[model samples]
Target chain A: DAGITQSPRHKVTETGTPVTLRCHQTENHRYMYWYRQDPGHGLRLIHYSYGVKDTDKGEVSDGYSVSRSKTEDFLLTLESATSSQTSVYFCAISEKDPQETQYFGPGTRLLVL
Target chain B: SQQGEEDPQALSIQEGENATMNCSYKTSINNLQWYRQNSGRGLVHLILIRSNEREKHSGRLRVTLDTSKKSSSLLITASRAADTASYFCATVVSNFGNEKLTFGTGTRLTIIP
Candidate 1:
């Protein structure tokens, strides 16, 4: 189970609308990440947090933002969803460093039409 | 751009047979990790090999790293239907420190019963 959970397992929304996905972890891991999976592109990192209020952009971070106000919660938001943003979003956490093994949540399937 | 590339985009094998997948990266890395994603689900960490290590094993899975070639291989012995999934190799660039991982395009393995 990875002791991780993501809200709204599946969602369908129209383009230009704002969307937010939540990830909660019980492991108290210091590092959390958000990634999107797409066909032919693999998994691309969107954002990550090394500590509370400490977040950074990842490989494909455009139009996406993340926040970590508490150790157990991380949220990813899209200011204006786009069709290209329709993908399976996954949340992962590592106990120590990013190089360490990461535990992933069940994932959220978002469809932006 | 630091993403790894997995070889044999897809593979089909019968249950009980061994399956092998290879991954090649472009830059030096501190560590290599393998993850598995079943259909409609998030990924699960499988194994990790350090840059200084040549090989590692856990249960029926074996991982090998060749820094000279910037490549790695994952081997699964006595594969079963449950082992059917997409496998990805991720790398943490040596120069980038421990921040985020760059993932490969992945290899889809189908086990025939």
Candidate 2:
């Protein structure tokens, strides 16, 4: 599993509430990414971190945020959840090299109602 | 707005048969990668083929990249019921780091026993 883990494998919450998901990795990879997958959408990049405190928005970054304060942990937060945000979230890590392969975490399934 | 798009949104095959999926990308890329995901699960890395490389193989999987056509193909030979899953192709452009991956919509494969 590439030593990657995501907490709260399944979660259900009501709209307008705050939610946070955690991704931890044993490997000290330099890059971490958060993505959301839904039917017919495959996977859409939400946010990515190149280094601690250095992050960038992806194509679908609205309503979500990410923080990487340490090399081993990356967090995704939803300031105010909405039903449209319901999807499976995955965290992936890769080496600093541009051509390195990415390893994914088990994923967190979030449902907002 | 997806950089990569896959054809045949779904595929069905019997055990011991070969399953082939195609992915087309809109722009030039440095490399392409394939990934597999079981229903309601995270994605697993499969194979990667660089732009300079035409084909690659790992176990029962074979990947072919055609840079001129901006496309790639994944073939799982002698597939099994366990191989039933969704397959996606990701492309890495000329980005400096690991932020290069752009995933396709994916193809859902059903392996009938």
Candidate 3:
């Protein structure tokens, strides 16, 4: 269970609107990641943060942005929602070991109309 | 591009039967991990097999890695209805400080109880 939780388990927004999903963890892991799952394409990385104020782009980071101001919280924002951004977003955390097993949050389902 | 691609997009079997899923990767990896995602739930880490290791076992799950073939397989013995879920294989590609995981589309397993 990893003590990870995602807020707004479901959301519906219109195109061009702003949307932000939150991921909170109690494990205090150093690495947090955002991923989107879609049919046929599987799960694609959106963005990830290694520590406070340190972030990096992932496989599919074009329409998304992320910020990590604290160890327990990571935010993923869609500046302007698009139909293509509709997917189930999952948050995961891992310890300092790069090869360690990752713990995942419940996930947030977002829909863009 | 995805590092791993799972074979058999979908599968079905009796509750007591054994189930097997295979994953193939295009490049070298530090380790390969298997995860299970229940419907509408977060993914749960099942097991991890490092590139140096040929096989590993966790409970009823057996994972085998063949680095030469760039492939891996997960075998679940005596399956149950609770085991019905989408199974994914993720590969950790380590590049110095830049390390990230690439996940496969997954195999949807349906256990007929």
**C-alpha DockQ of every model:** 0.83, 0.68, 0.77
Which docking class does model 2 fall in? medium
lDDT of each: 0.93, 0.91, 0.94
CAPRI class assigned to model 3:
medium
Ranking by lDDT: 3, 1, 2
Model 3 lDDT, full chain set: 0.94
Candidate 3 displacement at residue B101 in angstroms: 0.7
Query: lDDT tens string, model 1, A45-102?
Result: 9999999999988889999999999999999999999999999999999999988999
Residue B98 accuracy (lDDT) in model 1: 47
Fold similarity of candidate 3's chain A to the true chain A, as a TM-score: 0.97
lDDT of 1 by residue, B1-113 (tens): 54699998999999999999999998888899999999988899999999999999999999999999989999999999999999999998865464468899999999999
Clashes of 3: 0
lDDT of 2 at B69: 91
Candidate 3: give the clashing pairs.
none
TM-score of each: 0.97, 0.95, 0.98
Q: Name the candidate, 1 or 3, with the larger DockQ value.
A: 1
Q: In terms of docking quality, how is candidate 1 classified?
A: high
- Mark the regions of model 1 whose C-alpha exceeds 4 Å error after superposition: B96-98
**CA-only RMSD, every prediction:** 1.1, 1.4, 0.9
Tens digit of lDDT per residue, candidate 3, span A16-80?
99999999999989999999999987788889998999999998999899999999999999999
Backbone collision count in every prediction?
0, 0, 0
The prediction achieving the highest DockQ against the true structure is: 1
